[model samples]
Target chain A: METIAHKAKLSKSSPVVRKYRALIHHQQDMPVQPDISVKHLNKVYADGFRALKDINLDIEPGEIFALLGPNGAGKTTLISIICGIVNLTDGEVKAAGFDIIRDYRKARESIGLVPQELNTDSFETVWDAVSFSRGLFGKPPAPDHIEKVLKDLSLWDKRNNRIMSLSGGMKRRVMIAKALSHEPRILFLDEPTAGVDVELRRDMWEMVRKLRENGVTIILTTHYIEEAEEMADRIGVIRHGEIILVEDKSRLMSKLGKKELRLHLQSPLEKMPGQLALEPIELSEDGYELIYTFDSQQEQAGVARLLRTLGDLGIEYRDIQTRESSLEEIFVGLVNE
Target chain B: MNLYGVRAIYKFEMARMRRTLMQSVASPVISTSLYFVVFGSAIGSRMGDIDNISYGAYIIPGLVMLSLLMQSISNASFGIYMPKFSGTIYEVLSAPVSYVEVVLGYVGAAATKSVILGVIILITARLFVDYDVLHPFWMFAFLVLTAITFSLFGFIIGIWADGFEKLQIVPLMIVTPLVFLGGTFYSIDMLPEVWQTISLFNPVVYLISGFRWAFYGVSDVHVGISVGMTLMFLTACMIAVWWIFKTGYRLRS
Candidate 1:
């Protein structure tokens, strides 16, 4: 590490090397790396309502992380603590190698938050709002850069329009532009699609993906499970203010996920016979199909045993369908568990 | 605190206030004009004079003070209360704008409105009652000082209140009543000795006296004391605002 630092110092005069150095600092090799790390973070309001309880999470660099939870489930509280917008009752958080309390400026400069509400000054033009956000981070004016952000968010055309004139969706897009103004390494979107129409939702998703492509790590909290399923590289589920699980999306699905097996019967049976009744079978509404729901994580779903019992009961099934559980189901199951 | 942040937020706030310019600019003028008409001409026509000055001339300071206080309180409180109602406080809080920038931007804007209203009232008063400032510099100074002081008080009120109903509670229930009881229309000496002593407890008394002294070179209370009290209030309000911002107060935590 010392030699590498020495070598990098020798090449500082080169613009290419200077840019590389700007991205990362020379530190001794540590296997663990997190763009933002929250350690045992806790938040208790003055009224003694504990909003967050010992929540721990380490968001890796360049991953789109989705924090999924019900309302009042500490998702917003966690985000607020990480952004230094809320005080922590206890614990520590580091963003881009800066402790939030000790080095707030650097920690704050490293992150950008697009809030759920359309909170811009209504009288401000889109241009001034975005540019001023940049200045808040102690950044010098970069009009070309600001113009690019506006264009990317499709806001350049309305740059001069007052915020009050824009619709709810447009105001939300302006929020993303403001959050992006500082060019932070980490971006947080708190319910980025809440109350937004379908068209603007798609635009915001694409814009967020583009930001991620530019190497900005994105952390988003959403009540919509589909958003996390579609956009996130990793999923973290918080329940009752505690992080229950955080895992790679695919790996988690394969590990603790479930699949439902459905069987349609040829005959409409008013009631299940004794043999089949002993099995975990749910009858369909029309009395023509028998549904069997079991945890896929179990070593034996007892499909063979159930099949033997169905044969004995003379239950016929010409068609069979299998469905895997969705992230919604997974989330509900985890929260329940 | 930050140049770009302050300018950006300030420009945004100023623009928001300008959108409803008719209400902000016209209401104060009309309200003050009524005072000029009723109190200036009607009362002055009957009473003749006080302190060798016509009743019309005696009320000019009151009219200007009345406009300045109303504009200051409304401008400062609304500047913040709307954002809070709109749920945009989080955006501003999360943004790069420091708390100082946020408070100062609103207070400064409110003060701007107060100053403008004060000027309008002064000009309007001249049309009814003939009065000249004993010292124009002190006149302007007193105008700015009072504006800043009350705007800061309004800033504190904005942060403390949560809703539109709560926002108006302080100004309507407290400040307006004090303005009327602050000897705006008459000298406190005219009151019984017990009531005269009670009037000193009202902070608005100092503000009205200081402002009246600037225009007439006469005051019920000591000019130095009024200015000193305003300074004390200004410093105390600033400290409270700064502390709130630093601790996040009702804003963050």
Candidate 2:
């Protein structure tokens, strides 16, 4: 166990070593292999709540796919359907080329899920929990593989500790370890870093990047849109039980994303006379602030024209500031619209 | 369904049960001993012989069935309920552990627990009465059937129950009351014609009566009918539990 842990520690962040890792099989020979595919998927709970509606998606092998949406936007329902946890009321799902409903065992065996909830048996040791998860997938016992998973998640020293004994961050790592125990080709992380600290979050980011390099297809969901921006290769936005937009990260930022331009006057402003509002700049209720929202895709924000209009009005500004649109802002704006 | 996954679930469940050793094995032994002390001596004396057999001997099958019923109900119900309660059901549901494996693992453990408790009670009864096995096969058959039926029923209760309070509703309210009034203390033959007919509606009486017929070779109901009743109940429960799993009735949602 120690030797395996040592090897894992030595090669964790090295992408070359990760790419050649034996158990991290990405299976590059199949060019058209989709890690998971969903077709017009729909789910309605017993109580008649439609949680998912006509969802169709294809996640390619070895890519980081992020599913983003507000609460009740069918993020968990979608992942659950793909993982074969929740049965769909309508449509079909396939995981690693097997139909989820018809070939459930085969489909589920290839995928691993890190659920949103912080769920672990408090009485069980970390080793037992991860091992039990592997056994659940009908995998034969592989202690070395388990050790490597634990070390990769930085959970080697905590292996003998009870789950309740670990801190929130360590417990989160344990969840990832449990999910990866069976050496699945695809791993789904549903809000994996919800309650962890900054360092642990960075550590998880590195681990995920390493996992990706090793050819594992990763699907993650999070309210923290920034994590998606940092880790995801392609972005999908879900709203009200339907996938609204899916685009490349850079393309989405340039296409639908916007930046905020705020000119903070060094001198406090008096009341905005009704005439000053005609330039598309809104005054705060307090009458001391000016706000401008501009699209980044545009060649120019027409800042010169606005300033020329301001100068003609004889409004002297002491300072100006511009804030670019982040993934968080674009996400919130998309959902609202 | 893969049997290895079933076995894994069984091992995990049994380990959990063993962790609370007192609840599964010891508690039943202790409680059955107390029943023999109070009911066998205190109540059996006044009740006199039942159908040419001592009152102590007559209620033996009923008492054994009582523990069997309770244990089976709790074993399956608590097994599944704990997962749902602790949010570990997410791991279970997400895993390759199919509903068939889940039902078999949970119901199998429940049946195992019931059989264990039944044997313990029978061994303990040796100190109190002179009981002999007339037909060991019949006794074994009834024991297995009763265990499976109640365990399947318990599996249903586990699935239907919403929370902690919901888990107790069937065991405390329906199952226990039926076991007590199911001729455990008195044979239905001693009852008035109207009461005897009413007792027929209590399905538990059939289970206890069937078990008594296995042991003593005499019954208020025909042995063939008792066996048939056992088969009928076992079949019904199996189908119902299978359907619940197939549709993912309460579990999937």
Candidate 3:
């Protein structure tokens, strides 16, 4: 396994590395407790459609966990069950250390869900709508907290405006404001930036980072792979209602990520050299380039041996470039597998 | 007990009523006042007194009951239905609130609104006729009980309904006709013996009769039976609501 120290040496100032370091330091001081836990959870809809199979997951507090899946991969169903909006068929779910079924009030109180749909009370002022959400979680009226949440979302000026009068992005901000109103310990943002403008999307990402800094655990589902690449500390891929993979972002990249070396030769070769026939390399269609693909995590990458072999064989290369597979490519490969 | 959650839902619904004051409060008040004018003063003055009470005064309880039933169901149904329609009900469903608290907040607000409308219509009726409540305590009791019962009924309708048209189906086709035939403008005693017996089958007859008995100490049926029938309906509505929450019918999947 590649260690965090090894990854840190690769990029000293990477936010993902810094976050993992902070998580390790925090874990050493206190007993580790998952903010959300699922044990063999299963859900089947009324129409006999199995939305979720036996699944298990644990998300640490203050971590940004991203769930990546296709349209019908049951991401929303799992969230709804945890948030107590939908009924689970069997198994157990606990949030903030409370059983979601038995201690539902406490569990739900600790959670704030921003659903994928932009549902709001159109006739209500943004202030009332957000304050109402706080009250719904059984919290006392705290104008200062509401004010802070509004200002953080950049919605203070539109506080008195009816939600129907706001723009689409403003309405999206109102949804986030409402979710944050109660100061929940865990926040589930389901496609938070879907259909939002670029500016609002960036603002949402910043707010999420700030919330994480304040020790709020965030679990988000998104179709945007770049979003997961940008924000998530851990990535989970769900396909056909089953969790296929879960790993630290850096570890996943280092383990599954592949590197390709393309050597542009000075002279075209009709075919591979007889002596180099056993090498894991390929010739370009026009025989102008030599391509070698290798796992990034391998200790002996064989690049030095290949270069020495080229020199011994008098195979001249004018230029060489390497490329690593992106997370999108790895994700697609995983889903297809 | 999520009291704050209940209060939040209650206050939110009440604020919605306030926002549509002209429709929620004024419309019913004006319509009830019109009933007093047309049925109480205009046509009622030409009719003979029944049970030694003025025809106009005799119909006061029935008319109030009519408006109470309609408004209670309308207020509660619309209050809950709008949330479902706007897709905002997910918040209520996911909140740290029990089903009991949810019903208390919604039905409580609806009942409160209907009771206030009942009182306003009563005060407005004083403009055209004079009436007395022989059983003042029972009069208020019936008003509150009927409001609560019908509001619970409305809450169920709101949950059961899938579209706007379904919301009005029960109130328009079933409730309105029942009220019209249940003696809102005339006593059952004024009908033929055959029709009087048939009118007993209508549940609204018992509510109107009990309320009329509170006003004039006379009724088409015994006061105990009227109260019992209303309680029966109330209990049935309670059971239906309990079932909806327990089964998550039309609520959760």
Candidate 4:
């Protein structure tokens, strides 16, 4: 099915498709600059705690890149340094092709940040706050743009209300609006949905998708594995202030995801039979079930052979079930490792 | 030259002042009026003139200078400090603005506020005691120069202070005492010779002496010396503010 779809996509002759293909070809011929790039980045705090260690990363334009990490993994520190909030100890960073240190004004102008903390001007009305953010980037006032951002965030009605009066969820949305106020080409959302409700999370995911469609490069750091699984085009896992893995989401899942098969035994066994002892299988504590673990991508998973061996050994099963490891399980395993 | 960024910060600070109009404007005006009622109207009526100017009018420049210095410091300090305390300063630090633009926005608004307050007080003094600005241009220059210098000093204080109490410490413990001893209500000549010499060491003496000279053409010190002293203080404050931003002292980590 996927092959046929791929073929169709390749064969499509519509004018719009052709134009898009030509545009992509043109872009391929030209050296496309990464939206964000960091080389040998390091951050050491005053007390001698190293927050980030020789980090090197590049985020392509218009991609939804989710950075997943355990707490204290230096995700916020990296983002803060890139945004010019926290000072870097060493190395270079560039945003939207502008050097972060030498061309900071242009670099900062191209990026917007939604911080993890809900720090806002409580006394400021929503409209003023959003507009202020736009102006802070040295952008001219665009009331219509501000209005659109507010409406998009479902904050238009509260435009005149003081931020102190808003609910926590609304304040989070306001943070997003403020980040988008300047119409930046790149956005960094640090735990965007940390405390958000499921519905708001869904809405935010939709909004993010829409933003990507409009060509905004989104780099989001998330503790929620599901959020990354749901929204990331590419996933990067960071641990101990170092990126351990970066790969396409589908590739990562298929490459690392493990499969498990369980067979319920017809009768209890005293122990595993000698012949089946060497197999990648485990007997349940009660001896009423057998669980086999295998890499899904292996050409020979040996499921049939295992079943035949079980039958020849006179072991019968009532039913068999298979389970695929989820991203959360994979994440926990990687972190533990 | 991120004018928009500067304007944004300036407007935001100004809006805060407007939000607390009673405290920012009315409270100081009313307190100064009380001083005028007691010291200017009642006491000055009983006292003889100094430098041939009515005692009531002699304290007018001193009173305006006193308020301008204090208000400039407090306004600029609080303006920058609140953002640091609430974490909104992250936005400013991360914005496209240079340090020059940041200072221009904050100090400019603070000085503007002080100048406006000074003008209002001068008008309020009209109701209590008649006075003249012998050199209106010089009077305006001193008002603006003092406001800007003190505002810059306040900005430095805001960056240095990690706590709210520290914000008030310099303005209260140091500034208030200096202003009181700097001849706010009495000339340094009224003091004994040794005390006068000591009073000359107070920086506020130069500010008040210069401002008083602008008003009645009579000053405790030469006007050139007072202007030079004010400029020197302004330059020192500017250097402190410059160093603060360049080093990211208490701002970035």
Candidate 5:
């Protein structure tokens, strides 16, 4: 009921709803529409395996959204459906206000997809591949735009090089250049950094930020929690073919984040105190330290109580510090449940 | 009809062919020349003539048609199958191009390559033996019609095939054997009446006979029947391609 209520409120302000209201009010103002909207989307493959279930997502213009999921969590399936590459079994998708099914050409024209695979035209020069991709979208030749894309990807030096001879990182960049060649309003990157080296990953993240700055809405799916932590404005987690949670990146971290209290003991003990054993506290190996875990959302009153109890039990700590849980931990916990 | 999309895909496929020039153009041309040398010049001379035409000139249309059929199918099937194998087809699928544009791009390029090969084979045959084209315009028409028809057939094969070996199965086992037995080397009239009757059922027989007719004004089947049959086969292949795209068979998941 709560979920329904939340969505109801959201729809009232949603791009579709706003557009409806604008039409009713005869307002000349063109409200900024969602870059992409997926409603109650479900996918069941021919083999009787369900890949996505009741997914609803709305990406605002220019927002960088990150989709995090474990393997087989339908991240690619969701992206594929929106890109018009995979047909949806149920529900509807709209990209830049065009229905993905009914207005497929228009919808696809507004979107770009950089797939996980490093598939390229091995015999063509980098310039031709990107130019041809833009042409495939029915866009007129814009050599300047192609040159800019190649330059932005640091591929200007190798523009004339055959795709087969470029390094793996460069090949991936060429894919990005191709995806961006048509100057799509929405971009979907499926595991863009998967298997990429650290330097290239950093470069790609920087490029994604720049693209967002230029008003391109970017949605990338990755298993790397840190990538989401560093990039996403909003983060969504998917598990077992279901989207379990979606929240502001900071909000999700703070809501489920835990702070660990670690103590270094002056004197070693063989076992944890019985009074503290039931209090979510554990004695470390060699009995030199004790650790306590608690929700960061809660007050620190429990910490003072734990300290007082330690004093009463004649347990002394040399030093203590608290560390908030990282997004990786929170992600693992969410999927594990 | 997204001409730009068609042009892009067509140019891409053509570029790939240029990169593998030896295999795509040279090999087919060289092999056809060998057939002319062995079958037309050497062995054909001993067999004399068929239908008042020298044996070498008699086999010119047959040999050209044989390569055109095989090359058209092989080029198109391989062109599409490679993208599928390399997983690059997703880009094409995700683009704004419709299925018709995709077919036009691929099949058009394949047909163009086959026609070029047919022309080369015809010129190469002249170097070995003298042959006269009775109807020049009709000869060009038959060349293009056959190339386009077989290229569409090859596009279907590409979609149906999943493996590298499967890509070759139809062109090698089915198409080549049909051409060989479809009276490419000898006129079906030379066989027993029963054998000739059986040969009439082969589709390749109509293609070769029609092409042979364009060259010498002599054919086993009527010119009208050959054109009708080619159009019918082309329509069937086009329908199969349409169904493949509509159903997203072997393409979408």
Candidate 6:
């Protein structure tokens, strides 16, 4: 980290870089604010294809905000609009207090986007690609900054290699390096680890965590529920072009997540007992097991009451086990609903 | 102006051109030299001068313009089409650089390559045939303007084309045929009176005729008309490109 600061000092005295450095220093002095804000954003295509409805989202500085959605759920579309890759038909987006359109340069300067597509200048060396991207944002050439980004991405050894010669995982890392080349205050990873291997995915998650620790606000879009569960400080569920839910990761899991209690009976029963029928419980198809579904958020899951009621009803159980729904199930449940 | 952005994109494109030197520069130059060898050397030795200059010398400007038009469009179109094909255009579009800067970078690099190729062909033409640029300043001016104008035209085609075949369609089918019919080999007066009037409608006629005048002070059309038509087409292309960036045509989702 000190190496990065040391290299930053070697950059030409570009006001943009200096201002950006000051902004980093300034970030600590102020209260946390949304590094990115989307207000009533609506995107209706010319042919009347509504890709995104009125959407409002805010990403606080220094937090990982995950936008989770199924395919064609407008996750990429919303990100595109904010990044100015796609025009917003109606609504406003601001990056670091600069409106995306009115102050597009400033907005873009503060944001780095790693697109879902593995698009790169195939003939360009990894070093040139990242360095060029930084210059595109009008930042002065900072070899130190570029070197740090390459090192952080574990791409320092491959800096001189052409992009076409790199593996898929390395290409993705190059894309990340290019995005971070300008030291953007906010980074948008549009599906960072879609087709990567487990090892690479773990490495990416670790890298994302490291970026978050360095005060870079991250907003990643992923269809993988586990990814969001593991990485997001806050998660937003988008479906059919609308934001259905946005909440803290832990809060979302505990609130919408369900827990199931299954009792293995000593003897088969033909039907659910009449007394327990009033409760939210069902007899298994085999008639030897009983299952109860309860909200994990409830103060009391009533497990003790359930056990006592089973005793009064002369039911005997060999064993009982409880399971909390994984984020995948919760996500599927939300989408289906 | 986003000068750094322009330079970044420009340098990247020029670097790509370098990496594929055989395809981008060598291929076109060699092919054009073959045209000079076949037409200027063998055929011209049999034919007489068309307009007070040697048959070989007279066709020099036309040949240069022909290759210039095709190469300018080909280089610019393919340069931009590659990014779109690979989906790397999103990086450029999402960058802080404005549309004007993007165009300046890509088209500027394309035109620069075309100009370099044109100069190379001119030098090659001298080795094969004795030709003097009667108006040296106008020769350079016409060469650069034609390169830039056709490059901008190619930029439009790049944006409009969705596939590789679509990219080649205009350069091969339309532009090449137009250049052939635009008095590239012989003066239009050699054609029947009716065909001469029909040939005037082709935009390549004005470009080739104006360029030929710069080399030998002889043209089928007035030099003023040629420059005017070139400027007019350039303005039209600029407007189309401006509209493309404004509406995000074929560029954005």
* TM-scores (chain A) of the candidates: 0.86, 0.83, 0.88, 0.90, 0.90, 0.88
lDDT per residue, candidate 1, A54-81, as tens digits?
A: 8777876677889888888999889998
By descending DockQ, how would the candidates be arranged?
4, 3, 5, 6, 2, 1
**What local lDDT does model 3 show for residue B238?**
98
Model 2, residue A5: displacement in angstroms? 44
Model 6 C-alpha lDDT per residue in residues B177-238, reported as the tens digit of each score: 99989998889999999999999999989999999898888999999999999999999999
Taking the tens digit of each residue's C-alpha lDDT, what string does model 2 give over B1-253?
6676677677777777777889888888888877776767677777767777778778888889999988888888888877877887877777787777877787888888788778988999877766767888989888988898888888888878888888788888998899888888788888999989998888888888888888887787887778788788889988888798788776777
lDDT per model, in order? Answer: 0.80, 0.80, 0.89, 0.89, 0.87, 0.87
Q: Which candidate, 2 or 5, has the higher DockQ?
A: 5
lDDT of 1 by residue, B1-253 (tens): 4666666656666776687778888877987899888988876779856667778887788768877887787888777777777766665676555677777677888898889888888888888878878978988998999898888888888888887888788778888888899988888878999999999999889888888888888898999999899999999999998998878777788
Minimal lDDT window, size 10, model 1 chain B: B1-10
Put down candidate 5 lDDT per residue, A98-200, tens digits, no spaces: 9998898999999989999999988889999999999999998999999999998899999999999999999999999999999998899999998889999
Query: How is the predicted docking of candidate 2 categorized under the CAPRI scheme?
Result: medium
- Tens digits of per-residue lDDT for model 2 on A146-202? 999998888999999999999988889888998999988899999998988899999
Error of 6 at A186 (Å): 1.5
lDDT by residue for model 3 (A166-234), tens: 999999999999999999989999999999888888899999999988878899999888888889988
* iRMSD for each candidate structure, in the order shown: 2.4, 1.5, 0.6, 0.5, 0.8, 1.1
How well does each candidate reproduce the native contacts, as fnat?
0.40, 0.60, 0.94, 0.95, 0.86, 0.86
What range of 10 consecutive residues in model 4 chain A has the weakest lDDT sum?
A1-10
Q: Which tens-of-lDDT digit does each residue in A50-122 have in candidate 4?
A: 9987787877777788888899999999999999999999999999999999999999999999999999999
* Residue B230 CA displacement from its true place in model 6, Å: 1.3
Model 1 Cα interface RMS deviation (Å) = 2.4
User: Which candidate would rank higher by lDDT, 2 or 6?
Assistant: 6
Clashes of each: 0, 0, 0, 0, 0, 0
- Binned by DockQ into CAPRI classes (incorrect, acceptable, medium, high), candidate 5 is high
Looking at model 5 chain B, which ten-residue stretch has the lowest summed lDDT?
B12-21
Return the candidate ranking by lDDT, descending: 3, 4, 5, 6, 2, 1
Instruction: Write out the backbone clash pairs for model 1.
Output: none
Residue pairs in steric clash, candidate 5?
none
